[model samples]
Target: MSAPTEVPHKGLITASLMLATIMQVLDTTIANVALPAMRADLGASSDTINWVLTSYIVAAAIATPLTGWFSERYGRKEVFIASIIGFVAASMLCGIAWSLETMVLFRLAQGVFGAAIVPLSQTFLLDINPREKHGQAMAIWGAGIMVGPIIGPTLGGYLTDTINWRWVFYINVPLGAVALLGCAAYLPHMARRIRRFDFIGFAALAIGVGALQLMLDRGGEVDWFNAAEIWIELGIALSGFWVFVIWILGTEHPFLEPGMFKDRNFVTGLVFIFVIGIILLSSLALLPPMLSGIFQYPIITTGVVMAPRGMGTMITMIAAGKLLRVVDARKLVVTGLLLTAWSLYIMTGFGPQMDSTLIVVSGFVQGLGLGLVFVPLSTVAFATLDPQYRGDATALFSLVRNIGSSIGISIVTLLLTRNTQINHTELVANISLLDPEFAARMSGQLGGLMQSLTLTRGEGAFWSVINQSVNAQAAMISYVDDFKAMMWVTLCAIPLALFLRKPTARPAD
Candidate 1:
């Protein structure tokens, strides 16, 4: 909206922006832990309960690209303030929703209104701060973006356990109010432009993004391509994207400005952010289930163990902010990637018997790595781009990162499910009376137990023990496999850092 220059009340402005950003980002994962409680209260089936999440995700995906156009046409300050008001109102509506249908509708409204807050906040920070402080600015911004999701489940779980699931949504009320006031009072007004909207292009892109999100969110539940619904969604997604690309390339005034792609640093940064999103959110998606299902961790303990990751991220992000002043941004990115890969490699060593120590350690290391990367990546992505395209660029940047997160979570989850089944089958196949080791064990500790009970009871107990052991081992192996796969993904992203050109030095204001 506004050019990068000296601005008054920068501190207040940043605080306001971050509040809104955190409020919006927190909702992304905060509702996850409350799903079960919601399911019971709303009288929803297991299958239908997920619409609470899917509705928000799809609505956000479809609405996000509009941020650029809305900000340009309606003024960034006005749109941002309106988004906060709408989001808070929607949160309240969600909190008080009486049925599944109403909850999904409220959540969709929340997503649509909340979609613009993040990108606009980023644009504001970039606009308010000069180029030299971009790393610091981004570090502040990155902390909220990264740490919000990390703490979301913990907060949600705590609220749900202490009070009820409704508090999860209700909690946003006070925070949103403060943000709304701060923003309305201090956010500078940007002049609106009278540009023509590209309805066709916007429609096509929205369809593509919406369909893609739906496909990803529904695929695992529906057995992926085996379900006709998944196939239809996939086809629609591909077709929508193809048409959008073709339309945008040919249109005089495209929905997104094509020139944004010409910047090497910005383009490269998108690729990196996409990968970061995968690593960040997918690991988060995997950890809770692994902890609760395999380790038998209660919600609070799982939250505590997971808390270190966010702490690590916050610590390094601040450090990286300062580090950017002296170090090469590309070098910092490479180091971050290596550190992330190293953490994932450690995770590959996970076992059913291991304690939380390894999980905490690996998570912290990964957090450090992500923090090191995020600030510099955010700074560099916008460093070489023209201010005119800042709105669209930031929106696109967020969209790509989110899409990456969706795709990543889907892939890892699918792999975990399939691999666990395969591992379970293979492990079961190895068990036989003819195998000497199996027979020895059965005769040793197993023989004593079997002797302690009747024939029918002993046989039942024996098979139950074997099944439980097999299932745990199989699931653990699957978790490790997912970790290994992500490690390779982190490693693969390292070379892309080489393609980033250091931003040319900017003159002092």
Candidate 2:
């Protein structure tokens, strides 16, 4: 039961949809850097401050199941417009909140409504246009979604450093207003049969997804398996996810049809999307802290360095969109993964002596990899899915990507934390056992003995200085080793791609 496609002003529809998606995507990362300033202003703890991010993600995950249902029950145009208005108002509230709790609550409201814009925008764009050109629609829309994070932190860093963090929220107002107005005026009312809302499915999905994100995000921070709250959350997540699957399987009408997951190509496309999601976001998330904290880069400088990745993506997306009509998508993905692996290799080569030139090169290469793979993957996905099923597929794709990012960040953060401790420990142990020759030489330099700066003993503190030097080098080794581990993980995509289907010269029409 493929939905009949509509004729459209391909260029204009593409513009409006991509603009909406860009605004929403930007909101996801822009507030992240502002969290520190938020902490200072609200006098909150670091652990508590992370709720600004976790709440937003959890809200989106909980509310995402409604996106396709709403689009079908109402009109895509109506839902899209309402989403823009809701997101804008929430952004205003976020900027003006007087307390940490208020700001977090407002962000939840923002995420709940804001969750639909990205997938729906893409869904709408592809639906209105000729099926063969959906890849072009994806190209236009992906430029916004894929490039948002790259731009967000730099923009956030600049705003926080130069003016105020409130500007991050304030910045969303104009962009969102324009998008809302444009959508209201220009978005088409494509005629299609709508379905009844699935109340039971919605409840199960909310319980399952909300509990899952809550547990994953808070569990590690709270010391997993030790807290009573976490175990309860675990129970909710398993029950909800498993039960939702069973319920959706039996329902005559579901929020998401159980049949959508049966498409081999759709399943393959999802795996690739998740892999790319993890690679792109985890890298962006790690870069700001690594550059500013470890490498002594300023906020603005770190943000600026990461900007090349966005630039590369923008360039490659348009180029790859045109190529999808000619190239095999799986081959493009394979090539893109190798390029991504190579780009990560470039990143791996960086050490304590890294400079702007190296950062720029690595970011640009990685961006190229993203752009090359993303467009092709997107084009092929819709090519195989009929219009009737596009909404279902789109929602699932978005969910996988979001989950991938959560998993990616959590894994990287934990790895860095543990490795830092191990590296520091080994460093301490080796320093204590100082080489026989080096110990003698160090002792001689310090005038023949160990001292704790007690002048009464007539001794100098020499061995401590040597130990300090040893500790510093060990710390550097640890950071570098952790970085190498991340680079290796980037290669994980290659094996995953082996299962992808062949890409043809044109999208299905």
Candidate 3:
């Protein structure tokens, strides 16, 4: 592989690629807010409907490692254009899906086509831009990648509310078409190589990623290790990973090149992004439900309140891009981690009756942290690596981040469910006939109400209100615990930044 040939329409190329990047990243979180609507429309059960998301996630993870090989065998322009077309077609199919099964299948197809977009987009942007401007380029790129997840729910909610859940998928059509045209017109046809396909490595990696994703996605639903299916998935994930490790170490041409990982900065960046993925995406996953369920906000209102988060990230990313010229990248990462941890800590203190201001403020702060970290981290990660490795390295980077996000979402969701149950039981156990404190509390709050309804102590109506209150409180506590856990995770990322070496200054122009 040689250095990227210059394209005359760099601006058009960048815009087109960013459009595709945003379109793809938006799908990651956009479907979440519409899940209820989908369940109702498709007449699917809670457990089964989630395959709409799970299928896409698993398919994308399995196919991501193919980017390098695809780009190598076929030129980058060919693969990218085909991906856009395929993804657009899949989105249309998803929009028109008549059943849950069809929806899952369409989503899986979308994932497979969309997997190459991000890594290829990153690689293309890096290739077009001068080394000195990598920070600025990554900032622009990072804004699309990072802010899409933040904006996804709000956009999904608005579309779902105004039109229908199908519009969530339909929205991709026009965007994808425009991107495809721009890419076709502006992106250069890079040279291709006749690289040998590493089938064994790919199969092993695919099995490992596919199994791990399934385990993470379904573990909570089936009670983790207690279920035979969960145990089987776990065993498969471990076995696949073990095989992949051994195969990669020995294979001459592995699915991923071995030398890519040998770069210290690149390796450390992987760990950094993984932890960042866990905290960043997991918080986004937790917020909407908390707003709708705990605070009782409408879907549109939840989206509106969350808008500030993306704004914060957008503002800081541009600033971080400029600051990279004057500041140490490692310091920026550390600062970002502190801000994220601080926001999470604030979240842990949220009261059940708190106003939306807290949500907005903490979200904004977290967004700022994410922007500061993502721009510099991306710029610095590949600063020292060979240009030829960019395709593979970027793919692996995206894969690790996705895996971390999957694991993080699953962990918090599981903890929230289990902790709610534990807290509910404890609260219920203390609400007995002998406890005067419980009696006084219940009587004071619902005395007149119960009297109006002719309800006696320990009656269904009386206990029903009490139980609802207990459940709400328990869920709030569970949410707070999740926040605390995320804060610690953010704090833990601080040490990893120490391992990253600040790139030396480029020569004076």
Candidate 4:
């Protein structure tokens, strides 16, 4: 059957696409908390269990660039339907996985299929809706995108705790089934064109992305750059990326069209999305461990505290949707960067002794700021670009965002660990028996408390406790430093906001 020129059953199609989008995005983080349980049951070591996450990330990163080409080769509906089926089947296989190897393989398959869902969903939403409603549509779509990551850990923890770790994978079955049916019923067909596949370009891009993802994922584990594997991966990543760029520059039908980059707004949008991605997922990566490990909060409690952040995002995203029509998009982005930076600045002041209110409030504010930035950014980014380029552009947009997040998380986590060690050494160096500060502190409340516990100053137990306390304090200070660093990063984006041009209103919308 030929594709309809106009969107049919728009509501059903929108809901279906949203479900598919949420299902795919949710998998990115939902399996993290469940990893330990999977490891224990499968008799896998710590090193091997991580492959479950790495496999998916690398596979998805490698496959995502292919989405635009695939959509052009096959119809959108066909690719989306096949993707849903493949993803659902893969999810089932993951749930039934009896070994670590099987689990990793299934996860890879899931990643490959799941990668298309996001770009396709974005393209579909934009295609079906009128130009004027694009902002509202994107706000809805962005909500699913943003909320999925926010709630992933909480949902995964609940599923793993209440039932079993397998349920996290299994939960996708019903949801995917509904989405599949909806797509089959409501999604329209698109005209397919036969374009010559750029194997060389694709290969180079895939190798680069795959190697980069591996380097990032394994860097923290293997001590980065020190390990031969990391160096090799880094070399491969750099070489492959440049090779692809060079090939695209010279080739007539390169994988990525040069025309897309010609648009100043799209180019600026790329930089903005990259920064947003870093801010979005990196903060998320830091918070859970800080809450659970440092603050001694339970998983559920951590989730509860983080929930308000998502609520703030949802509220502002809806508002930003309406604001886009009236306000200069550049202003919204500036306001967002400042708000996000302010939130991170507040987080830098956090101490282990503080209550959860600070976290909740700051998180909500940051979310509001991010929500404000994301909607307008998406709206203006695509406003001047040709509609034919939407699929490829969205794929690249998602790719850049994902890469930024991966890099951001890796850098922050490494810094946190390294800074903690540095801080630990500095703090420990001062606590010598000859130091007067140590002596006076030992004579104060800390000393009095230790004395009441019947622990003598020079005893092994007393020294051990002192060392432990120093280490804990050092780690807290390191976390604060990381937050401060992120704040600066957010603030740095403010000036770039000036580069973004306001989107001119269209009569068609």
Candidate 5:
């Protein structure tokens, strides 16, 4: 293994890298809130407007694996710079897009360019920093990766409500420009290596990832496996993944180097990161709707309520960075997972009539837990791996994390929808005019009002009110169940921390 690269303007390079990373990561969720506005402006149907998001996701998934090959064949600095330019340019195009078709095209271009920014950024940070500083470096990187999604919707909602939805895309222009210039000026140039591009492997992986993303993203909208489209996508995804694995194992020069998996730390890190992705994004996915739909909080208020989670993550990440020097990384991971699970457990107590205090407290604790886990887990994952494979390793790491998030969000959403109906059915089963007890309670509570308004038990108005209450209660219960489910998921990941080996220390430079 080669010595880590020594760069003088490490801070500037890191700033540039983070700007690019935050820019890319923010796009993943930032556009979500803007979808309705985009649909109205672009004259798109409810079903078709989703293509705007789907295009970007599918494009990014297909293009992410190419990061390693691109960085190695072309210089890392060169590819990084180009990606920034392309991403920024695409963002501008997306902002100015005249039609849904144009918007989707621009977003596809944006995803293609932005796909390399994250893994490359991680690779660069790991390269420039010394072994001892890796904890701090990863903390910074993880903050952007984790926090961007947390804040994206909030920022997007503000932009849409205050100005226009286009600003969500336009906001990237300045950030991307700063990142582009900084990277071009301060980022070190890595030596380019000539490697044969594995077209077969690339195609197979692309097909698999793209299909899987489509299935996950589209599943909720189409009601999951009830729709034939999901089944077909699932089959294609499985077949593609199967072929990719088999081909890579047999091929002399695989798209992704198989040797990377042999590193115990790296493999464990992948699993850990996958679980983290699920926990991080799935909770984020569940919160906004719960706050806005059930609590009647406005978009801005929802963002504000959720802000503490990000704050806690940021604070803990800084602390965790320093803690890594004196603490076992594996132990920190266990502690973090426990904290997250505890937070989720708190969330299970949420009710339709409760205040935001519990939400804030639980989010903050989860943030702290996630921060503690992310920095050390990232540092340890790469500690024993060869620097030469960092590009591919980081790309694979990002890909797995994303897939995990998609899966988590989809599963939780599906459950939430199904459970709400089930709960509603069970609740309604007990409420019938035929039952004397139920009739007496209703008459006791509303008999006077019913007489004044000339309303009766059989009236549509009275039943509508009852149905609404039942629906709200059912939805609230479903949300709590989702939280409880997530808590269990977090607990399941706790034992996996034991599998992680502590990284050996290196002498200071």
Candidate 6:
């Protein structure tokens, strides 16, 4: 007798997938704001507590490539269901962890499970949704990816402040339970030809992603190449990544197919997703620190300001879904890119005492642009894909976007650091003048400060005044320089959107 076919209920399956995707993405940043509380409770130092985050990241990164294979062998329903169950169990363990080590381990387990949620869910949605409506299906799914992190930190911040950090993980319990049950009841499991697991590819991918994440997160603190651990991890990451990239291409039975890359529309969609990931992740990484360090907004306030970005995303995605039927896919994507560019351009003008309304507007605009891009790009990738390859394509799309974001975060962090130094150097040079007019101006301010402080008029007073002025100027210029650099990067990404294979209009009935 033939095995029972898994025929997923469309509404139930889609909801389950969406819920799980949101949970996975939210967990990535939801724990971020609660790190302080977690540090104290786990009796761990700041450095040690970082593992809670890193472990999850490494697990997800390593598990990403296996999605295609897992879905192929086990049936998409089984793979997805098992993954969410594992994730829920892990989240529970995380909440109950008595030590930092245990929490880190749990987080790692969560990552392993969480990694499958997005790609598998996408595959499930495609399986259930009608071909003609695939674009709209992607529209809803794409919003989770784009808006998850935006809402995560805010949710985390509120939960941690009002309740305990453990509630954050515990909250996922009920949600995951519902998702798992929903999947079991409604997910349509298609028959799959099982293949032996690619242990070699898996190991290489795991090591590469783990080492690379470590390097990105800790490189700055350890002074980059100067530290032994940093260098060792860097070596492992590069060699592993290079080997995997080469092996995947050279081998016939590699985890991902080389032909997947051959699809012009898919590849083009990937390009947009990759760049969007970079822009979004890098901006998220950079923005909060600036707010706290320069603007001194509390954690909750920071979350409040970031809320507009998510709101914009939700609003734009809903609108984009309706508009999809009217507009060609290519035009939708281009419009998204242009809007994102404009949003970044506005951010370049931020300064001390900038209006609060303007900052929120800028964030909202950024979200709107991202919403438009993410949905269209996601749908574009699958427009011509066969059902057999949907799992592989979805996984490939996710992995590439993540790689882009990682590279983006690393590059932007390095850029900001580099630009800060340059600005600092130039600012100092301008202040150290020997000109008569400059000296006179300096002397006037110097005397006023000295008189107020009741300091003696001499070399000491002049030096003190100059030093204070230079420090203030350097700080102001550093922020200005960083914004300008980000603006240029986003603007430069604009023309590259043209390179993507434009989506075509469907024929009339």
By TM-score, the best candidate is: 1
Model 5, backbone clash pairs (residues 3+ apart or across chains), number: 0
Number of backbone clashes in candidate 2: 0
Q: Model-by-model lDDT, in order?
A: 0.92, 0.77, 0.90, 0.89, 0.91, 0.78
Using TM-score as the yardstick, the better of models 2 and 3 is: 3
Give the clashing pairs for model 4: none
Model 5 agreement with the true structure over 387-450: per-residue lDDT tens digits: 8888899999999999999999999899999999999999999898788888898688766655
Ranking by lDDT: 1, 5, 3, 4, 6, 2
Query: What lDDT, from 0 to 1, does candidate 4 have?
Result: 0.89
Task: Give the distance in Å from residue 487's predicted Cα in candidate 6 to where it truly belongs.
Answer: 3.0
Candidate 3, 1-509: lDDT as tens digits: 44454558899999999999999999999998899999999989988999999999999999999999999799898999999999999999999999999999999999999999999999888888778788999999999999898888889988998999999999999999999999999887767878888898889889989999999988988898889998898888888889888998998878788988878889999998888888878988899888989889998899889888898899889999899989999999999999999999989989778898999999999999989999999999988888778878999999999999988898899999999999999988988757888678657756666665554554567667778789889999999999998898788779888899987642221
Off by over 4 Å in 4: 1-6, 451-464, 505-509
Regions more than 4 Å wrong, model 2: 1-9, 225-228, 436-483, 503-509
Q: List the residue pairs that clash in candidate 3.
A: none
RMSD of 3: 2.2
For candidate 6, the 10 contiguous residues with the lowest summed lDDT are: 1-10
The runs of at least 3 residues in candidate 1 whose Cα sits more than 4 Å from the true structure, single-residue gaps closed, are: 452-458, 505-509
Candidate 1 per-residue C-alpha lDDT over 38-63 given as tens digits, one digit per residue, 9 for 90 to 100: 99999999999999999999999999
Model 1 sits at a Cα RMSD from the real structure of: 1.6
lDDT tens digits, residues 98-183, model 6? 99989988998999898989998887776666556767788789888878887788798889889899988998999899888888
C-alpha root-mean-square deviation, candidate 6 = 4.1
Backbone clash pairs in model 1 (N, Cα, C under 3 Å; residues 3+ apart or in different chains), count = 0
lDDT of 2 by residue, 408-452 (tens): 777776676667677778766755435675566656754344544
> Any runs in candidate 6 off by more than 4 Å, and if so which?
1-9, 249-252, 421-476, 502-509
Between prediction 3 and prediction 4, the one with superior lDDT is 3
